[model samples]
Target: MSLAFSERARAEIDRLLARYPTRGAATLPVLRVAEREFGGIDDDVMVLVADTLDLSPAQVRGVFSFYTHLRRPGWGKYVLQVCATLSCALRGCEGLADHLEARLGIRAGQTTPDRRFTLLKVECLARCGESPVLQVNDDMYVNVTPAKADAILESLP
Candidate 1:
């Protein structure tokens, strides 16, 4: 089957593209829009994004693969990105990741069977002072301990 953005999504992407001087310059936002529209960037969606932005599919895939924050196919309702940078590692981020893995029953880079949560070990949340940090979707959780992580999971709807 083919992929296409809704009219509203197209209009939104067009508006965003207008802000940039060239379509190539608007790649990231366009990918974001495509990700949201096509329900995460798979091969077909990448082609759609490339055609929309006048970019190569490889170019679109490059940007998508570079950003761990971007969702992919089979991602769950909540994406748990645990920082694995030096600062976070120093603050017991490894234990935090272990806790999440055991609790979610999935290893890093894997999604839960129920698709409620997907665990990941990433670079940084840009909150070094907080040390151990976890990013749930667009929201950041600083100073996250195993206990705090449980509470955070409970807080999710």
Candidate 2:
């Protein structure tokens, strides 16, 4: 299939490409633009990004798979990733994860039916001192508890 990027995406890709010395070097940023434009990264999205960056579909897919933090297809508006590292686990992250699952009515790695929240168990957020960190979209909430997590969700628009 012939894929076409939106004008804004094309312009943004061009701008990102200009910052890099090689197309390969521009792959990640171009893929970010694609991710925002396409909603989430999938095979078709990889193909479009590959063509834009002059890389192979395999190359784009490889990068996407390697970066687990990037949004995936079916991800909800709020991607809730609770840190599951040793420090976090020792600090009741498991309970926090369970609470999130129960509250959202979906297990970790699943999105709610309404697509408002996707719960995931992720690695360290590097704030070990503040264990039980929860990342919602791009924001990180350190020292998170079940109650605080619920409050955070309610605060979203």
Candidate 3:
């Protein structure tokens, strides 16, 4: 079965495409819209997007696989992506990650039992100066200590 977008999603996709000179360049935004509407980018959604944008399935899938933001499977409401690069590692990110795991009872790459959050060990959040950076949903938190991380997680709804 092919994926279909809600009227609101279609309007958002149109607005997103208008920002780019070429519709093809709006693939990322379209994918995000599809993901938000359908909850994830399945094979059917890829084809649907390709059809909507006049691209091929191969083209859609290529771009989808290249971007980490395009999720192939559904995730929890909160996605906690910790920077695991050298700088972040040196700043005690691993310890913070351990604390998160212990407190949430879910390891990296897993979701909480209540399905409220997912912890991901990501490559780099591009905050070297603010080592030990993490992105929760769309917000970035930097210079995180275990205590700060605990407080952040505790504050989540």
What alpha-carbon RMSD in Å does predicted model 1 have with respect to the real structure? 1.4
Q: Tens-digit lDDT track for model 2 on 18-137?
A: 899999898888878877887788888899888878889999889887665788888998899899989999999999999999999999999999989999998788889998899998
Candidate 1 vs candidate 2, TM-score winner: 1
TM-score of 3: 0.84
Q: Residue-wise lDDT of candidate 3 within 33-135, one digit each (tens)?
A: 8987888898999999998898999999999976656665657778988888899999999998888888889889998877788898888788999989988
* All candidates in order of lDDT, best leading: 1, 2, 3
lDDT tens digits, residues 36-127, model 1?
88778888888888998999989988887878887898999999999999999998999999999999889999999899998999977789
Regions of candidate 1 where Cα sits further than 4 Å from its true position:
none
Question: What is the lDDT for 101 in model 2?
Answer: 90
- The local distance difference test score of each candidate is 0.90, 0.88, 0.86
Task: Give the higher-lDDT candidate: 1 or 3.
Answer: 1
Error of 2 at 119 (Å): 0.8
The alpha-carbon root-mean-square deviation between model 3 and the true structure, to one decimal in Å, is 2.2
Error of 2 at 32 (Å): 1.5
Off by over 4 Å in 2: none
Best by TM-score: 1
